[model samples]
Target: MAASPTDTAPPEQGGTPGAAAGFPSLEEMQHWTWVIGRMQQMMMEQGLAALPEVPGVNDAATIERLHDFWSDSLTLWQRFLTPGGAAEPGAPPADKRFRAEAWREPAFDLVRQSYQTIADHLLRGIDALDGVEPAQKEKIRFATRALVEAMSPANFPWTNPEVIERTIETRGENLMKGLQHMLADIARGQLTHTDGGAFQVGRDLATTPGQVVKRTPLYELIQYAPVTDTVADTPLVIFPPWINRFYILDLTPEKSFIRWATQQGLTVFMVSWRSADASMKDVSWDDYVRAQIDAIETVRDLLGVKAVHTIGYCVAGTTLAATLALLAARGEADRVASATFFTAQVDFAEAGELKHFVDDEQLAMIAALSPEGFLDGRYMAATFNLLRGRDLIWNYVTNNYLLGKDYAPFDLLHWNGDITNLPAKWHLSYLTDLYRDNLLVKPGAISVDGTPIDLSRVATPSYVQAGREDHIAPAESVWKVTQHFAGPVRFVLAGSGHIAGVVNPPAAGKYQYWTNDAPAESLADFVAGATETKGSWWPDWQAWLAQRGGGQVPATGARVPGEGALPALEPAPGRYVTQR
Candidate 1:
């Protein structure tokens, strides 16, 4: 007897199996056949010059890989009978393929087990492929991931037990709601999970007290109302990633970095980037940097300060670094006193899983999707979520579609769901120059605003931080920035992923941080010698910033509403944030 496609039936002389046994239906088979064909085409385009030469006739690593694959295959048999549906204990942290409730059903259990066995073997085969270099391997790895994720039992409405249970419970209302959500997504040209009502900008989410002092076609400069009687002579200006709302740093007063910074005697001004649409297609990276520069000049002039300290979070850090380089080249380097980067990368060589999507094929796909001159934020959200599919994608699927429940009012989740668009030219340039070309580290490889952007020339005292568990910007990758600057660099490793790393307030006193001021031969050495302290990194940051300041002055001198050429444009948590 031979196994059925879904591994439920033993082949008979001439017998048709029931669909309930977890066999692939004709439509599913056709869909997968087409997908496999497409993958083959991608493989060919990626240059599979010849059949992969298997690695090591019988090397230890090769043998061990084979043994593991065989053992997992055997385990699948056991799983089929008992349906020990939990994921394997030692499974790679990234693997989330077996969490579906359907995998617990005896029939679907076989389906999942068989798929996992095949996937494991497929990955092993790729690892064993001798001649297929890293470039080809990346494509193959991506293709395999696509096929595995697509074929998961959870992806199919019928095979998913949670979806089935919800159908029975609601007499098909779940299906109707799911359909409505899908259609609504298509109508809006975006993917959304939470009800927007779950969070109201200025009310629930971005409730910090501030006014938008200056507006640019490209961005808005926000001057947060002072919370202290006396403020630092040098104000702190934040350049948040334009890809998402700046409010992530200001989400609710309790977790608000803006509120915290203001209360700590630091005047705060943040760049609130307008959500770019097809109309802003011609916007370039230089335009964004120039806008930040304009904001800096506006803030400095209003506060009567010679310079402001800069905070760049994620991609915004990249832009701020480039802006400083531009200012340095123009001999106006005094515009910024010091710099801080939060989970941001100036060097991209070790940029993690997000790098998987920067190859020629993926970039072409992105370009095709952004023909309107801006990449849809929904697409960006979907791609980013794929890097952590279990937590960001499937979990929401179960809660929203399968369980037929409204999303709870989670501020973080709401902000995560509020997607933003990217200008086509700027994003493509970022991919080419930073991710693909890695020109920023090369010094003079790329020019920004007519200045050859070089991080080596960014001599301002700097604070560089990375999240220990950050998958996007690995801590080691962030550590490399220390070598790029001519000024003193203090590198800190905080205990959390990207967002939480920065949002951590000292009051929460949650995560520990490791700091090492001494330079090292390599990032490994830096981490090995760093001293770990139990508390938020924010206090360490504030203490560092406090030392860099010239002096403190009465808060009455801080820019009030309608103070200069950059008059109040709107309130804080401005229009751009609520564009969606």
Candidate 2:
């Protein structure tokens, strides 16, 4: 069956099935007994490439940790062999992998405990390395984690009690279905995270009422109808990350930030980006900054307003910051009345595990992988999956390929699976200039449209928000933006990861945010002084907008797309979002 691509490891494109390579004797000998093992062979097909070698047991600190590992293993073995109720060693806290009741058996329990013990010691041993740089240590840890996650017994049928029980109950039919799933996935060259058929862009997702007012080679501008009789005088334009479609902000109506914002007495506009193609290889950072400026100007022209409020979520936020800088450099800072950044980092110095992938070798590999200068989105998704290997990769491997279960029907995962390509020039610029060189935050360090960008000159009032647990844009890195912007900044820390933290709507009331009236340069000090608040940060943000002279007027006079300056190209959520 055909499927949408997911943000996990892609299937092996051409290599032979791993079982064929690992067990050449399988074809010559009886294969019935090895059915389960054969079903799991493909999981090992894509090994971690270019992992840094970790420090071995050379020093006393490392030797001591190794001894502790052995000592723990001996204790677990003794407990397993001893008399009844000798207390089976516990698995790591909150580890759902071994939660199956079938795993309560002494042997499987021992397997779980043993895996946990070694994994713990392995990490601790890395901590004991003295001379390694912090960044190098993190890279080694990331690579080791991928290896450790792959080695879990739960990934294999023979050792996994749950899989074994299911196999016996189904009389081996589960293995048959699992093998079929494995082959189907291999043929598609991508993993299926959610039921792809469960949702479509126009029908179920991105269903908020709107029209594509302007379409360009780079992006489409969407102007949504207002819900209230009165709207703020200034329209709010949202620039979502182009990695995926804009629907993430306009999911189902209940979850749609776009829809909800309209009802909050504000005119809403969205920038739906076109996925990069072969021709866009040379469309660099200047084009993106110009695109953002173009969108802002387009919104202002359509509304007949001097300035409009702006938002940049994730990468869009980073681009928006650059656009702001560009505007400031040109003495046109009034174009954007107020700026809001959602989980965006102006400074990459304290970025998370993603920084490890920015070095020269991997980038050359990435460049070689995409000959047309159009990097397939799956490769980026694969890198993201590596950061959360267990939940996003191995979990799906166990469920879809080993247990023969269908993936859950989820809206978010559907959006996540929709892959988009990136322009190589823009991508390389981001990796080398922003991430590797840490140049974006430096005044005049990088130029957009040949104009040097100076963040200090960007005196536009700003609201900076970060997710406390965000791995992609670490909150610390995000918090540093507060120090760079010359304008008054209010920093809020949300209570989730990157996607969830930003997408949270007020009506959902799901996660809380923290605020600190007391000023602090460091995120730790900022967080320590922050007061916890209940519910979503949306209301707080809306209130912030109102404070910035986002004054309201009767909505009966408010104009819709095609009714004013620009012609409505088509009904939104636009042709661009649904293309893939």
Candidate 3:
């Protein structure tokens, strides 16, 4: 039986066999695709390609695969070319990507089967390239997968049945709209992910009430008002990644993690990192750590507290780990009451596919383009999109460019498109010190803020959360977090990928989580003993946080943002996040 390609099928290449997979944004993304292949080839020539050992080709297996490929192709050809017969290619029962009533017919159904057959054969052929080094071989496989995805029948307007129907129905109005979208995205030099007017930073999204208590050159410190009558004594400060705005946590009021935390009786503060510009081109990692310490101190002074609970998401969590090491080196580790890492990796030995784009060659190219000293957030965004090209890159290409659909009004996607620039020095430092050396986890290997850094010194109580399907920071890498912390470490596995897994709130009641308090030898071992539970992981984490929250204080006496040692600079969300 022919296997059905479901929309949710875990994609290894091209794209998720989903309801929306496709080609490109007209011709724009194809150019990017070519550039990626070109860069990979150039980099491989430089002898920097990671290669696996050459495997001796199995003649018997190769012949068998070819025989199967031809057998399947012949069957599909016979089924589709039946004369005057209303032949239905095998029922696409499980494949959500092509279940439309329009797709159940002859020609449309043939296109779907033909594409899948060819995609499967092309992918299988890559396995025969045993002569290539394993590293470069993998690169070849990825590039091939990308090409396969880009060439999907669903991506092309001529081959896609729905697109044909839409064109006939709308009398080519959709084509004009699609052309407009393409021109706009081309002018902006970035793909449009959402309707710009759908959600403003402070109004429709990031609606959690708060105040910018302190504004630094590096970041704006936001202290949220307590939603409850009383709050945990140890205030919580969140250090969000600088690649984008900090509003992911404070998205819609219903989906907002910050608002939910405040409602849970926890005083929350957020670090809104300033968007990079020519003036910030020379800022280093040490400057970021210094800025973090300054924020920590600012929060400490505001509430007359000795230490505060801290949470870091993604890049911010990696930096927070570094900051913890620095504080430990300075004998001020106690200043952080507890540190929580959300999909953050201290060790990058198994850092997933991102390593492919972080080489010296890529950095050199970026530096040449960004002589002003900062890496555009779009570069980082594009790199990440490459990792999930089918879903993030091509799905919209098919929908927005070919189908001519108006941009959707999604708050999360709105946040996703809000890119932030980073100093090139900081980018080079982070990609080198953390990713290249994997030094953040090694003892006394790297120095930060003029102090020799060591992860072993970071004895702060730690809680680590990782998505099981996270491609950005693989769970295997996040699992390594348990080994480096000296304090009692608790690692929890959540369903879904990086952003959705971390930004998940309890109210919506989507996905599930797993936990195991017992010690385990590895990530796999931990999962073997872990107990799975339904719904969000927020409450479980909140329960753990309450134990170290330094008791509770009355709502009547809750410290407001501007009422503390520092004065309020502006309303919540702040101006820094408003920057492009």
Q: Best candidate per TM-score, number?
A: 2
Candidate 3 to native Cα RMSD, angstroms: 9.7
Per-residue C-alpha lDDT of model 3 across residues 478-560, encoded as one tens digit per residue: 99988988888989999999999988888778999999999998999999999999889999999999989887887543277
Order of candidate numbers by TM-score, starting with the best:
2, 3, 1
Weakest lDDT window of 10 consecutive positions for candidate 2: 43-52
Error of 3 at 393 (Å): 2.0
The clash number for model 1 is 0
Off by over 4 Å in 3: 1-65, 83-95, 556-558
Per-prediction TM-score: 0.81, 0.89, 0.87
> What residue runs in model 1 are displaced by over 4 Å at the alpha carbon?
1-115, 157-172, 563-566
TM-score of structure candidate 1: 0.81
Give the C-alpha lDDT of model 3.
0.80
Q: Which residue runs does candidate 2 get wrong by more than 4 Å? A: 1-59, 85-93, 556-558
Q: In terms of TM-score, how similar is model 3 to the real structure?
A: 0.87
